[model samples]
Target: MSTPTGFMEYKRQLPVDRDPIERVKDWEEFHKLLSEDELRTQGARCMDCGTPYCHTGIDMTGGTSGCPVHNLIPEWNNLVYRGLWREALERLHKTNNFPEFTGRICPAPCEGSCTVGLIDQPVTIKSIEQAIVDKGFEEGWIVPTPPEKRTGKRVAVVGSGPAGLAAAAQLNKAGHSVTVFERSDRIGGLLMYGIPSMKLDKKIVQRRVDLLAAEGVEFVTNTEIGKDIPAKQLVDEYDAVVLCGGATKPREFNIEGSNLKGVHYAMDFLTGTIKSLLDSNLEDGNYISAKDKHVIVIGGGDTGSDCVATSLRHGCRSVTQFGTHQKAPLTRDPINNPWPQFPNVYTLDYAQEEAKAIFGEDPREFSIMTTKFVGDDEGNLKELHTVQIQRKVDENGRKSYEPIPGTERVFKADMALIAIGFDGPEQTLAQQLGLETDRRSNVKAKYGQYRTNVDKVFAAGDMRRGQSLVVWAINEGREAAREVDKYLMGSTVLV
Candidate 1:
């Protein structure tokens, strides 16, 4: 701890945001960079707890927590505090393959479980972590460290999402020959298309993917197992197989008129737009654009928020979001979601704030559930029928819902986006492999082990655990790689 004396003296400081009102008008990251001096002060604020929960990456139940990738938080915090920037980055990279992605998009449970947060503000962990990774990129300290040796073992990673990439990175480091297969024309899966460039620039993903390629990771685009390439062929050619195809089965609404022309899945709109933007040959004109249209988004999750933001960019006449649950309190509710756990609370994201600033009110309508989609005779969605509902716990402690009286109403909607969530991984690959799946159709693999019933067939990320954050995918990838390595060598040193 280089600045222990300044621990209590220095307060937590996060990077300042650009003026929200102005920043929302464009597709760019709102958070500004903190100077080296500012970052040093923030790092110095870390109490660096004797029992640091931030880096444990495990919960009270002895399972994963805080950070899924299990980053060495204290070591990096200390390294940053001491101004040993390069060493600090090395420590950060020891566990995390892509701090840059997690740095920007991760919800940062590590901060929630932070020891300093018990009384005072958390030790600016997320901010400092972001600074460290970005600094490494800026200083060119981050490089392609290709393996000096290659193990003869061959591996095929299905799906080029975060998990597949992370697993490939680690396994390749261990000298195993690795190749990633992606059905999409371009690689990076969700990162390349699903996520908007405003939140995460696709070029940033491409940069990292390029570096991984230089380090000897082979990426095969437009190739999908059970389709373009047979599942049996991969199993025959490789010693091990990793499934990171991701949970692509979108959750559907049971409401009427869901099949209307103007109604679309959140991924369809977001992914379509990004693909067109990135690929000149691809035409996004076919995408569902809300320009001059009234937009209604179902669900209050990140995907719904993305819908709202994208609609605004498309120059929608008006935008509104419907959440089937009550609005959460702005402040943390320890009684509901306690400390050392992911605190449950309401937070204003960029999309909500953007809609609020533009529409003169928050776009969200909590406790409002869409009953049906009203559509024109031409099969185009025109409006949404919804009602407010109340939730109550039954005698069995199971909560249920009921619509409130006099709450039925109609909202104008030229376009509707369903963003409830994903259900499971698509069926093609799973069925082809004849792999066992849980009730949700997610590949059946215990969280830590990430091994499927089929020997040498491993699964990780959303494909195994259902939809989740990118950080968790990275964790699943690393852990699965460890298990795969062990299976091949009779023992492994991946962790």
Candidate 2:
């Protein structure tokens, strides 16, 4: 346990982030690391509750309440508090294959379920996790450990995202010759292109990928199964195959003028920007430029916030985000959202914070729905028609939205991004393999078993489930690897 009276001595504190104005000027991570002494104090704040719900890894109220990867939160917190940084790193790596990734991008449901959070604030678990891994790297403690004995079995992972990467890492550790096939030009799938550099540095993703390669995980990029490489070839060539292809099919907004030139999906816009930045530092003229334009992002989720931030970096003249639902409360509603459940609270993300700092107002407009997109004769998006809506809850608690009459208005927009969400994994590969799909269009596989109808074929991550957090992907990937190992060797040693 952490210091018995530590919670009373220290309060929850996070490292100060770089100023929003300065951070928006470049595509680099904005958060600064805390001093070791300060971080140790933060770790000491962990109460080390008898029931550590922070690592419970369970679902509550239709959302995850704790660390999806089941990270040993208390163990690591105690280690860090005692100034045993290396031990903390070891405990962190036991469950999570990529603490660096989660520590950077995850929304930290673990903190929401923290025992201390029921009263005041939660321990800085996410920050401490990052600190441990980063310090391990800096101290030259983290190194590649290749498997000694080869099982002579071969495995193939379809995607290079978090799930696929986790599965590949675990399978390779179990002495199976692993080959990861990526459809994109780079090895890290969404990590390489989908997310912006400012949030998760591309170098950090590549660093881990390179380490995996050193540990003998072969990577083949720019190849797609069922297209460039046939599905039959992979099944026949490998003893087992794990499908981690994420849900890439973007949910479309079927409004008028959606096909206009200035209108694009959020992924396309984000991916293009990152790719261009990687290739020619934006000189290639490949990415959609939001510079000097009145940008309108349709959707108020994290993706929409990303669009707003990206547009701000591009020096957009004006920006606005529309949400279909009403804003959540600033604080948790105890009766509706009790303790140990993921809080449904209104908070500004990095992009929105930057937008607010620059524009002197939050960019989000809640309970507003876009009805149509208007464009000029040259096929350029120019305006958006939207309506304000009021939510109505019936006696049975079924809620619906009613558009208020005379609330329709036109807003000028030179560029519009659709940031709605995803439906499921791309169906091309699933159809080619004849894999069964759930009603939600996700690959049909039991959560723990992770096996498909086809033998030697398993699924995990966003492809198996629908869109989910990166931490959940890691969990699914690790679990799927255990099942795959059992199938391959008739028994397994994977955890």
Candidate 3:
């Protein structure tokens, strides 16, 4: 609370993003940094409330209320306001292992719960967080500071997503020898491929990975625990094993013509595009290109938006996204959706902004359901059929969508992408280890206690909790590391 009137004195501000039309020409990060003075002004807006719900990290009304990682928000904000960049970065790293990742991609549930947001826009927490870390890197203050001594205890971390990376970082910091196993050819699971480079540049992910590697975290790529090697091998070799394999099974629609040539899962398309771009800058022709094609993306989540943006970047003839739910209200409903809960409001995401720039209107069609895919004689997708839908809630509290009468429509689509989300972690590793799974097919492990049925093994992240935010994954990984440390050394210092 250095500036008692800061929240009222300064107005909320954010950096202007790269022009949508211009940024769509290449696969690069679109975000820009605010000036140091402007960022300080934004940081000053932090009310630093007594409760400080911004970092409470609570779940309310089936939505995240604050930062899942429980970052020291006010502390860092105050530090940044005082122009103590290094101190702010240090405080940020105290809780969040990778502020760069979360700052850029996270939806920032913390801002929704900010005390200042009750009256005006919330403090620019995400932007200030990013600037702090980016400044640290620029000043060469962030470097590989490996553990001073090793415990000689080897730990195996499965998966290399945010969760796995966070776990490995913490375990290494605890002086344990940690090895991360990633099935992909690369280190980052979702951050490297599942996300488009335009949102999260792969270089940023690799930069952190390089630092982790230098910090004595061994990384083993192109090897899977269950398939490439027996899951028991890690159990026998390592003192402890932590499973951070994310929920990777994408949900699919088994509708008619789903097996057509142009039909593909959203991850497959996104992964291929990113891989191709990274490998040869799209010269290899190894990915499914949307060049000069009519692209229809199903679902309305972030993944779907990425698909739309990717298609536009590939020079698609046209693009449209479908969502079963209606558009969100422009403003929050105070009664049903009160303060501190994630506001269900409408705003133009980056992808939609790009689509509108080119197509003259928003590319999403809400309250629509895909019925079937129609293909030509060559088995190539030509068009798709859909129907307008209305959501209905039964008296028992079950919700369903019903088709509207005489509202069927058809649209030309050279390619169709399914991005409805994911189910849970793949089942092979769990079955191999004889681990128990919950009804959701996620590994049966309690939240704080990440141990599975198998002895000397732990599960965390999407593998244990099902598909969720990357921030939640990081939180799970950190907590799981603490539990693993306790199980190994009989006491733990990890926070």
Candidate 4:
């Protein structure tokens, strides 16, 4: 543990962003890393409590918190503070296969439980975490190491997202010949395209994909197993099949003019933008553009935030976000969300901050719903009709939302991006494979074990757990890998 008084001495110092105004001009990461000396000072602030919540990772639901992959937070922080960076890298790799991605974009829930945070600010754990992995790459410590021997067991992983990648990496380490099939044109599923290059650069994603390939994982892109190839073939050919496909089908709004032009699902806009960037040409009108238009994004999740940030980068004339729920409290409330649990409260994200900076006021409207979309004669959306509402959970545990009287209003918009979240994974592959899915459309797999109804077939990620953060996806992938490894080998040594 660092000195008790050190927490009081340190001011929770960290790096600063490169001017939000300048950053909004392009699709690039804004926050810069602190120097090694500065990182050490921040690391020294860790109290390393005897019952370290940061490492405990215990959530309210009996699930652990520190890290889903169980990265050694305390040990790595101490190693980093002592400048034992190589050792810190080793500790980080003990659990996570790709800290680089998580370090860049994860919400940093671990830092919230930092003992130092009880009084003053929390340690800059996320930035320090990012720095450790970055140093690992700079030192050329990250390289491909194919398993020493083949188990003669072939495994087919049905997704190229983080979950599939983690599963494949571990199964390969188990000496199984691993083959990953991606329906998209490129590997890395949502990582390759669903995420903006600014937040997660394509190069960073590709670097990991390349490493996996060199590690003897076969990647066959542009092949939808249910469409391009038969699902039965995967079962017959491979020793086992692991379904890591993500929940992709977007939840649609049941408002009027739902089929109008200039309206698109959030994934369509995000994925299309990435494809345009990949081709090095945004001139073909393939990418969704919000430039010179009033953009309205419905939903208050991270995806909606991304749409706002992306639209801002496209030079959108104006942007507004509408949320169905009332604004949450700024501070922790035990009755609503107990401490040590994720503080279910209101907070500002990067995009909202950027929007506030540009727009004179924050662009978010809480407890609001779009009544309908108004479109032009060209069948393109022109405006949105909205109303402020109150949401109350009923006795039966159902949610009911009703518009407040006299709160009706209309907002001008040329394009509307529905960011309400995902419904589930596309059903084509599941149906073709004859796998059973729950009513919510998620693949029916018992948590932790990840085995689907189909024999020797498993599911993970958003497909199994529904849409969630990349961190959770990593957790699902890692846990599923353990199960798959055990299923194949009858026992396993994987952590």
Best candidate per lDDT, number? 3
lDDT of 2 by residue, 1-495 (tens): 778888878988888899999999989998778899999899888888999999988889847899988999989988988999999999999999999999998989999999989888888999999999999999999999999999999999999999999999999999999999998999888878878898899999999999999999999999999899988789989999999999999997898889987998999999999999999988898998899999999988878888998999889999999998778998999998998899989888899899999999889999998889898999988899989999999999898989999999999999999999999998987888899999989999999999999888999999999998889999999999999999999999998
Each model's lDDT: 0.85, 0.92, 0.94, 0.85
The numbered model that scores best in TM-score is 3
Question: Using TM-score as the measure, what is the rank order of every candidate, best first?
Answer: 3, 2, 4, 1
Mark the 10 consecutive residues where model 3 has the least summed lDDT. 55-64
Off by over 4 Å in 4: 57-65
lDDT of 1 by residue, 199-271 (tens): 7877789889999999999999988789888888898889999999999999877778888988888999998
What's each prediction's TM-score? 0.95, 0.98, 0.99, 0.96
Per-residue lDDT of 108-219 in model 3, one digit per residue for the tens? 9999999988888998899999999999999999999999998888899999999999999999999999999999999999999999998999999999999999999999
* Model 2 regions more than 4 Å off: 392-399
- Local lDDT at 136 for model 2: 94
- Lowest summed lDDT window (length 10), candidate 1: 56-65
The residue-level lDDT of candidate 4 at 132 comes to 93
Error of 2 at 49 (Å): 0.8
TM-score of 4: 0.96
Supply candidate 3's per-residue lDDT for 334: 91
Candidate 1 colliding pairs: 151-175
